[model samples]
Target: MTTTREAPEPVTDVELVVLLDEGGSPIGTAPKADVHTDATPFHLAFSCHLLDDEGRMLVTRRALGKRAWPGVWTNACCGHPAPGEHMETAVQRRVRQELGVDITALELALPDFEYRAVDASGIVEHERCPVYIARVDGELRPDPDETVEWQWVEPERLLAGVRATPWAFSPWLVLQAEQLPLLAGAA
Candidate 1:
């Protein structure tokens, strides 16, 4: 008699975000889908800037169906980390899920980046978001639900564009460019 074993089903965990107090301490966890509102509480999040081998930065336009900042151009990716998940792990997960690409040389560029912005629709985004920079080496396969379009652009050109028309980009990206030395030369 021969016996065969079948692979077990994968577990699908409900996505929860780590909420933060005014002092930037973890207060609790909240369901991701229900957290954003006009009075969204401060939460932990991360942003990534992806670069190609030729040194062009990868930027993406948010999907029109996104709840906040839809159809707006922004960084390579941004996402909230799962409760108890490591920062780098969350970044990698979101990059793959949203852009369908792999990254290397992942480094934390801004360890204390935080922002609070209100979307045109009045949805508030208050996040203690750290910034990361990474390199990609493959063709992008962006998900339509997370990204509507993408482009590889020179850092200087992106900085100039953001500075020239701040209203054309996401608030966080505009604010980040002001502080990042990588774009400082363009100023």
Candidate 2:
């Protein structure tokens, strides 16, 4: 007698973000797409600053189609950690997705980097974003949906530019530079 076997159904993955309370405690999870709006709630996210062997930082311009901070230059990558996802894992995943490159020497630079900003279009971004620094390990191939343009520049020069014209870059980048020792000033 011959028996017929059925194939297992494919599982669908819905991207979810961890929502945080005022005290930075994980409260619950929400769909990533629904979390960002005029009243974006506090969510767990991360920002990564990529550097080459010579210490030049990689910066990218946010795509014009982004809902928040479109067309503005910012750090190498930023992303929200999925529900139950590790912060380091999320950073690695996002850098690969956005810049098409892998990174090493990942270090948590700002563990309590939280910010809330309102874009000109009234879109709000409220995140408990931890900042990271990593060294690039592969060739860059930025995704058009995430990055329109990219360049590597000295961290000090980048800091000077952001300081001189804060309006030209992402609010988070400006805020991070102010707190990060590596970009604070020439040592």
Candidate 3:
């Protein structure tokens, strides 16, 4: 088994959010001067669409102990952009943070986009996100702090799971899945 380094401390300033083009590659990083104290401006994140040999996507039931969407079912891996970090760097970092595993390979996802939402429970500043797809064959160990449980299921099964447990995932995940074609396969 390969061990990963600890993720660096996050840079909360909006300016610290690294910049990426629609393809989730580094176009440039935000300048510190452009950073805002109110909310993370670039709030860059990476999430992978993991498909195993059987075409089943590995989904995780975020530990009910997560700060954002606890017990929510999300794509294989996800996490935020750290200061002075690039998209690729964040991708590896997050995979290790959420699930005790490092990605073997990652491919960019389609229709890269951003959105905003607020609930009484908490406010998210994920103005922009860069999605990815990683193929792996390793044991997954959910960090008690980040995720509670995880599983591998077919895409249709995941959709049903979401419907049965709406609050179990971030709203954006559901919307993103809808935008994707059912047959869409990722690298």
Candidate 4:
């Protein structure tokens, strides 16, 4: 009588805390030895909600060419810090990378606030986002690669746009709107 061999266990990269990249399959698991190796987690991120002196939020529409949530509307600026990079540096880098502008001053509102995306949108920002209201004092040039369009829209109109067209925003964006004082003040 012939017997079939048992399958071996899967493997995962301790550094990434994720399954090993096996071309395109998600069949890897953490090895028993490395499972408790205690690598630093990989969910931390940062974002800046820049505001002008007029109180208008600096909003931008994601480039249509994006793979996830393309053409969606979002806050002033958002990005993830590179490994070993500081929060301030990362925020500044992202602003330039996405909006082609620089932020002189930043205000940190929530340093430990985190919200997870509800889909496979390639976006998983577990951020300590430093929400800032920086006055605009420069040019505007939306990077075609990161942003398709950008403008300082009134908070009232922005919420109206969201209500009228909920499909134009990511789930997290909508959730953040709940905390905006624009709605109550406008009403």
Candidate 5:
């Protein structure tokens, strides 16, 4: 972990992300900005699906200011953990940061989900984003800088909407939907 001024510095895309080899072992690190070039390199990332007690899953729209896939509806949250950071710890922190909610348990639905996508602006996203399902039965106060809109919908309805308007959602979310069965046993 990098430190500065007697305290842990803030984690931002301006910092670095952990890279992985074909075997999923940490190989090295690269500045977040440099990792998403035209030829994006594979990096470690995560996606979280927040479900309410009523079986409604939360979905959020990426802030318009986002450099990639802005205004697109996606899973509850997505973020990258720094090198040596545990995935669960990262997800917990991200949920609190992005959704203003706290969670204690996480069920990893897709441990090997990976994808490479290039947005219209040409920025690329090549990541090994493991998907996790978490239950949150409370209001969502999303960070305006990270998410523009948020809502809860039944899993089946969300899947149907995404299929009916596939272009309205993120590519990874579409892929993640196909693997929803992995979350069948989740609460």
Candidate 6:
């Protein structure tokens, strides 16, 4: 007789997100899973765009099971840093968690990149998201629960696609692509 065991699942509960005031002050903390609602509280978050040596940007299609924005393509990764955590540290951790890549160094390309978006399911995301850009390369091993597909894309081409089919991507991804022209020397 033989037996099989499954890998321990990552904990989703009790993950803390730093609540923020209008000016981006950390006012309080809330569980990550409960933070996004029709009336989402403003929170501090970060989005990371990874560029390879060839200058291709990494993008991922959100898994269909995502409650907020299912099957929509977005940046390499994004997440809220725990209260009092550095954005750089959070980005490094998240990139490893979501994309299975180690990010040695990263930079805040757009510190004032904030967005308020409501998905079709009525879940709201009101985040003070500082966009970070990193140049990294590795064999991508995306978490099946988080991503359904992945790709490397040219920045200019990505911008054109976002303009042509805006609805096909997450709101934040579209916004990021729009700001690509301003991200000189990011790669």
Q: Please, what are the lDDT tens digits per residue for candidate 3 over residues 1-187?
A: 9999999977664534565555445566665444423453454665666767677778777666555566667777766676567777887877776677767667776536576655335644454766777766576776877766667888787777666776666776766675555423321
Q: What value does the lDDT take at residue 92 in candidate 2? A: 96
lDDT of 6 by residue, 1-187 (tens): 9999998967765789999999888899999888999999999999998988887888899988988898999888999898778888989988888888887558788788889999998999999999988877578888888888999988777777778899998899888776754333332
Kindly list the per-residue Cα lDDT of model 4 for residues 1-187, writing each as its tens digit.
Answer: 9999888846544332233232322333333223322231234456566766677777788888765567878887776554456768877877888887777766665554556453345444333344444555577666898888888877787777767776677655666665555544553
By TM-score, how accurate is candidate 2?
Answer: 0.93
Candidate 6 colliding pairs = none
Steric clash pairs (candidate 1):
none
lDDT of each: 0.93, 0.93, 0.64, 0.61, 0.86, 0.85
Which stretches of model 6 miss by more than 4 angstroms?
A: 1-13, 181-187
Give the runs in model 4 whose Cα sits over 4 Å from its true position: 1-42, 119-130, 180-187
The CA-based lDDT of model 3 is what? 0.64
Per-candidate clashes come to 0, 0, 5, 0, 0, 0
| Pick by lDDT: 3 or 6, better one | 6
Clash list (residue pairs), candidate 3: 14-41, 15-35, 63-147, 63-148, 72-168
Compared with the true structure, what per-residue lDDT tens digits does model 2 show for residues 1-187? 9999898956658788999999999999998888889999998999999999999999999999998999999999999998788999999999999999999999999999999999999888999999999999989999999999999999889988998999999999989989987898632
- Alpha carbon lDDT of residue 158, candidate 2? 93
Poorly placed runs, candidate 2 (over 4 Å): 1-10
Clashes of 6: 0
The runs of at least 3 residues in candidate 1 whose Cα sits more than 4 Å from the true structure, single-residue gaps closed, are: 1-12
Weakest 10 consecutive residues of candidate 1 by summed lDDT: 178-187
Off by over 4 Å in 5: 1-14, 182-187
On lDDT, the stronger of 4 and 5 is: 5
- Which scores greater on lDDT, model 2 or model 5? 2
